[model samples]
Target: MDIMDIARRKERPAHRVFSAGFYGGSWDHDVRSVLGKAPRGGADVGEVLSTIAAVEPHDTEAWPTAWIALGDRVGAVAARAAERGHRVSAARAHLRAANYLAVAVNALAGRTDAEDRLQAVFRRHRAEWDGFTAQSGWDVRVLDLPYGDGTMPGLLFRPDAAGSPRPTLVMVNGSDGSISGLWCEGAEGALERGYNVLLFDGPGQQSMLLDQGVVFRPDWEAVLTPVVDVLLGRDDTDPAAVVAYGISQGGYWLPRALAFEHRFAAAAVDGGVVDVSRSWWAHIPDSLRKAYDKGEKEKFDRDMALGFKLPGGKAAERTWAFRARPYGTRGYAETLDAVSAYSLTDALCARIETPLFVAAPHNEEFFPGQSQELAAAVPGAEPVEFTAAEGADRHCQPLARELTEQRVFDWMDERLGR
Candidate 1:
């Protein structure tokens, strides 16, 4: 059986998280055992981007991770692209790749260069978005509000006219999520089970990351209010009933947004995150510590030098490198520090008085302690913290459709009295 197959068949959360035993993400589990401090001189930029540029676009994982490492060391992979005569589009992509990496590496590590790289990526993409869009019908609209800059681009999906207003589920996508709004196994499963869905890139989400240079904010309510506003105005939407959900890193973003914009009648989440910085730092996994903490510059060199053999190796290596760096570490840390004062657990418990449903993998490797903390906060929240043995999938919902969608949405139906 394949690794995922074995993982699904087994009944352990640890098994689910370690299903990657078949993958190289473990850094062979030994390479990271080493420990030490970062070198003083830093990394080499030109060589890093040059190495990254050699990789293809579809290889999104590896490239970004390598870029993050390089950025942490030398910095300015974007500037390298510009210096190399990469076109405007390529330059922008390089920067976005860097942004993608920054996110992967977690917070900005309190570094200004990291923030600059991320902002540049977001800003450049926003400018490019001016003439390149394929949205149609009610799917694309201008949603303006009182926060930040007022007007923001948004896409809305309403229930088909064939039926009365249905329960609308607002999908608050997590960090740098896709702008295409294409449903993945993570969420498309929910749509099939009789739910009116509206997928949008709120502030600090993909749309903003790619344009507006607005990155994520501690106050996500600004985004949610306008979304609720637009939904209520739509004829096909049931203004009295709504459900909200966030995923991945979104566990934090979605709950915060719902806190102030408490229009949703219900809320849900998958593999959520709490204490973003700690979680981002911990994503490195216990296995990969040797090469990093032990200060094995040579092994580190191999990880970056080859830049292809690392985890997320086959995909956009440069982007993956970036994902491993500022985006994941630095940006994540910076934002975490900024929002450290706010508690998603507190936010949801106090503000989200509506019924809540939680779908979380008990043995989640990515973001641990978050679901438990959130579930613990609010009473009467249907906390289905499932283990792999008892019919739960990790990160995304890969369970029996009848369970994840039908049952979950059915609860929404019951709540809405539809």
Candidate 2:
């Protein structure tokens, strides 16, 4: 979805952590990088306003980066307005930039010293964390699982439900964020519903990049199996009802996890890889098709490819640039190239007994007919395709969020006999 469209829909008064996802992926890194770039060219009021508008972070850390990026110019505007005694205009600009950035960049769990400061501002301003408020019945702990020569962090979020070890949802996070990503709308919803949610930051997830120095991998299920053992051993989770759900990148991930390990009770995958390369290409929207067709962009594709991986393949950095950026991977072309080996369509369909939920968007630019693609993969695999248009909110449909949540929980509930 267009970043501007998301900004208009949220209609919040300030920048905060909650809005970070609106910026797309990597609110922490993107805000810092974008803001760092804006000042060199910002000449007058218009430039400053435009610059602040450009960095669109997908989450909370964007706010501070927003302020810091144009802090001098913004302060100058405010100061000039103040001298004229137009305090209202100056305050409005400051507040608006700060407010949006609060939700844009990720300062809450970020490493910078400003994390605390930014959080305090958000708590003081935004009122409360709208996503997750319940005291975590189960704590979220990150575990480092050693792989071939490297490792990825596994995040286990235990449910606080008071019962004989409830079912566990090993939430494989998307490619962009780290394990803390369990804080998003879907994962948080699962946690609140009393399921033990295990968020994994396997290859390419934030923790792997920042902490473990790992990049994305196609053989993600390999990473998941070990973590599954950890979750199974927990006193709080029902070993037999271990269901796995993948969203976005997780879509590719959870399927591979299931493909390798048949133990999961059921699987619910949304907006996942119909076929790796095809779906990776699908991440790019229709708007950029013309530019790509014209061969005008290289950077965007390069970043995507660089970070993307195919099963049993390597994650190479993008070899070129793209005009319009895909939210998560910067290397569009490279990612797509790696995804070219993509053929999850057949893989997911192979298992009919595995109750699968495949959600499709009405207007996917790259991989149109995702649900159909997924459905094609799993012949009778409980397909949940919806004709959803890209909404005023973002790329993954918020409109689909509610229905998707209900159908998934209900389906899993039936399968697990909960």
Candidate 3:
């Protein structure tokens, strides 16, 4: 068994002022992107904290407003820097401003409609991020990948290093994250190590869900196949050494993709998720489950209706609704049905032949012990458990991202013969 089994996660209030776990984690976690004075002189530590201090936690109505306020302040700094011909300074400020606004948009929870002001903030986030990459000497490309009928937005980061063909890491986003979120998570580190990085929103992910209404499906191969086609066909990619790295829910997504798309040289998941249904089930009350199991769809829906309506006000409603999109179900029964199908049967797990790395952190509240289950199911898949003692214990180790990145990429490097 993985060491994660011995390190049980701590319990916290369901609708508290501050949250730290993944399922309902706090918005403050985004500050990890700019922690320790990020943007190198562009982001003021005191100012960032001041922005955070302005709002009350679990206030969804006020969430986006506070974030936009902070974003605008930082954006002004970016504008001034650009005007003064301070390219590097402007780039850093723009990057920080973009991150701030991205979190702002994310904080708007259930308002996933493109016509909403939330989308406008996200558009600004992308624009500012583009400004940052252009000035940072990073050769980043914004392209559209051919998916089903239309296209999926993608960001490909080619290292400035000169090499005929370079190893590339294709980063996959999790349940509630975006490509922009991937940049601060692990993409920057991958680029610095002379590895090309690619980030894209698959079905039911980010803009795909919001703008296109593409719900997520269990058959991940359909999405990954085209992504592989785009990456390998590029002249700069080393076809033999492409690695698939999935984050958050992508832990389930990355391995699932590799199970069918064997062309990838290696694959890694920050937190391996063996069964989404199991995770969701563990969080629900037994009474609700019994009703749902009995196929009492209407009763189950009525009983679970008030669950999202917590005393925390609008924040509670938005938070639950935010999580509802993944299943794309109308009611509680359909949600269970949808999530029940989001699992890799033993047969599928046994078929995964690519080298695999599973990072299971202690105190992982979201999907504890699933990593060990994944490793045990797959042939030769390695599950590396990180302990709270090492300061790498939360979901995806967001606060300790550097440690997770080093371990994951190093394993990938060795697997790809880098």
Which is the leading candidate under lDDT? 3
Ranking by lDDT: 3, 2, 1
Superposition TM-score, candidate 3 onto the true structure: 0.87
User: For candidate 2, lDDT tens digit of each residue in 1-418?
Assistant: 3666566547654464333323443333333322222221112335434655665533234545554455434445555665676755554444333333333333433333454564454443222111112122345555666566765555556654354687788776655432322344356567767787766556655445444446566766578777777767777778888888876657767776666777788888766565655533444556555556566568545433444455312211121221112222434544454555435646454754567776665554334566566666765666664553323122244334555567778888888887
Where in model 2 is the C-alpha error above 4 Å?
1-64, 67-138, 149-151, 161-163, 178-181, 279-337, 345-348, 351-353, 387-395
Per-residue lDDT tens digits for candidate 3, residues 1-418, read: 1233223223444343223332234554555444522533334567666776665544555667777887787778888988899998888778777767777766764654424786678778777877777777788778799888899988788886454589988888888775555786788889889898888888898778867788888878888889889988888899998888888888888778777899999999888987888867776789989988888889888877777565543454455566777567777678778888778778989989998998988877778888888888989999998876776676787556778778988898888777
Candidates in descending TM-score order: 3, 2, 1
Error of 1 at 157 (Å): 2.1
Candidate 1 least-lDDT 10 residues: 32-41
- What's the distance in Å from true for residue 362, model 1? 2.2
Worst 10 residues of 2 by lDDT: 315-324
lDDT of 1 by residue, 1-418 (tens): 3465455435445445334332234221111110000010111234433544454333334543454554333224444544566444333333333333333333232233456655554444333232122211123334453346555655444323354566677776655444322233223344444456666565555544445545556566767777788778876677777787776666776666756676788877764555665653453444334565575545644544454566654433433443433233233223334545335656466666667777667656556667777767766667776665655545444332235555566667777786
TM-score of 2: 0.58
- lDDT score, candidate 1, position 65: 49
